[model samples]
Target: MDSVQFPLSTGTYSINGRKYRRTAYQMKVATDDVAQKFEQFEDTPDVYDDEPSAGCLAPPGLPALKKKIAKAKEVKEAKPESNSTEPTEDERISVIGGKKWIASISVPACFIGKLHGMNRRALNALENDTQCRVKTPRRDENKPCEISSIVSLECVQRCLDRIEIFVDDAKKTARVTHFVALPCDQHEVQENFEVFKQLVLDSEHFDASCKNPQLFTKSARLHLTLSVVCLFDDVDLQRITEAFKVIEGEIKEILNNKPMIADIQGIDMMNDDPSQVSVIYAKVSGEKIQEVANHLNRRLIELGFAKNEGGDEVKLHMTLMNARYVAQAEKLKKFTFDAKKILEDLKESYFGTFQLTEICLCPLNSNSSSEKFYDKLAIMRLA
Candidate 1:
């Protein structure tokens, strides 16, 4: 009988003058045995026997095999060490100082006025449980709440989580709460509007029954509304501002870097009957002005901040008078003014043309500034 011989290069064995190929099972068993030997060697000292067993003989590809095994062992050893020391997602903390943690959350501006029992209950519970310092913005303030320092970092995180849930719920049912407009703030334009306003107040054709001084728009607050939008909070305001900033270049391009001239001529009522009008406005017209207004309306609608009431064309007009400004008690009866006579008298009234300098995103029903301009959330300069 011939001695069995294994050929390292061919991966075959010769026995009793016969040759046989190594099966997958045999290769797997050999690999397992080698791995077990390597593990046992790692645990023991570096001492080696002068003479090795026949089964422990190195294979033809031992150098490459040793390198691969060493790399795999290193990776296996490092994995547990890394996992044991690093924190999990839930365990992570945003430390501000020694054992102090801080967390913040955004609350929509509309949430202040719309707060219900559920919101109050949640907020009260958070305050009582965490004893955390909760700083929320006022109704008029566009800012996020700053929550900091509780028994532990987890408490602050919990406070933020609850607030976020409340804010998310409020956002789902939010309405259009703002508008975008091109402010007619030129000194010349304001003086012209003041003249027009005085004319309406003193004209014999103006109806005495509807001539409440409060019905007139402030000269400083005069503007041609582009579109109305729903801005729930500072985050929404920031997003819309960024969106406008991106398209501002397009608006500037349309104007060709020249100051856009808006022609304010003629007087009109929003309703056809002029006899029972709730809104009186000055007609705004100019090729470039209309283009910019239409572009803004379209972009705002596409961004989901505004709705498309009808066509893409934005009707440009600066509101001169509104009956909604009437006293709260009389407003319930739906007070309106007779604008028919005033319309006939000022039909072709030119309130003068002025350069369009800036467009503003302003909050509705906000208190006017000292200069009598509506508080602007954002302003885009055209010239």
Candidate 2:
């Protein structure tokens, strides 16, 4: 009922336009006699791995050897040795960050293109200023700053396409995207991606260290950094002070409430320290205090600087330090509660009001070497 025939196998497969050897072995062993033959064949095959014959992709002749030599040459030519020196971290920033970042207040669509143009200008400047061998494409890819773009009709359409919802002043909504994929433009994603790339690069101070040398490092722990900033409008100092009263009321009420739990951190609400709260409450002044605060808070949210408890609008304040530096950096982490709950508790337990009008750019020096000094760049008053 069973009959079978085995044939000698020889074939070749092509991969990446090159041929590879293919050999097949087939036999049927039904009894002890055939089993012994199979065992003998295993011990000594008709074709050994070292043996070369016709149709084999690789052979022991000058032709095969020439092919191997050609391949070696190709690889050698493909990647030329570096005649140019690689730039240090600081140089990379200088090469990229030389352009000024212009942020638009009322116009949102002019954001990306303006950044791109500035980046191009920065690269051109770098090329003119340095002897470093810079490639045009590499320069094109450099995006040193984040700022408003010179808007075109097409850019406006794109911005409108990406907008999920609209918010009027004094309104809260939950449609915010948890995360946005950066450089959504596919045509120049890599080039435009650098708009945010340098901000996260390893600090220049510790790049020289062979081990544990970074002046700043990422941590798994999370904490809240808030900024209290004030911006004066079309008014004098008296009006600014009056505006501060409104902001002050909001701050005091939120602090007095002191929620039982921070919905975001899922931690004790009131047990956090007072100094941290103090840092968040410090007053700073500038014409654009509100604008700066809004920008900072928006950036923190965009970059996930802190887990939001999903309560109210994030208060405008400089995030002085993270939880990792809480032990040494002014010991401020103890003061920030579930600001949402804290404010709610304060509103219910005590009546506190705020009239905020100025923005302060303060230095947060965490004693840890792994954390670097950051500038609180701007401050604006909220209308």
TM-score of each prediction? 0.58, 0.18
lDDT of 2: 0.31
TM-score of 2: 0.18
For model 2, residues 1-383, the per-residue Cα lDDT tens digits are 78786644445679999996464454655557434443222222344456666673545587988989999999989986644433223322212132221221221222324322565674344333332222221223432222222322233233322221221211132223112110111223223223212322433422222112121222211122343222212222234345435544454343453321111111122324532222212122233333433444454444323235543354422122223333345544342312332223222221112223333232333243433223323333232
Candidate 2 stretches with Cα past 4 Å from truth are: 1-296, 299-326, 329-351, 366-377, 381-383
lDDT of 1 by residue, 54-101 (tens): 455675688999999999999988775322222224443455434556
Query: Over 4 Å off in model 1, which ranges?
Result: 1-175, 327-333
Cα deviation of 177, candidate 1, in Å: 2.6
Worst 10 residues of 1 by lDDT: 37-46
Question: Model 2, 190: alpha-carbon shift in Å?
Answer: 48
For each candidate, the alpha-carbon lDDT, in order, equals 0.75, 0.31
Question: Where's the lowest-lDDT run of ten residues in candidate 2?
Answer: 177-186
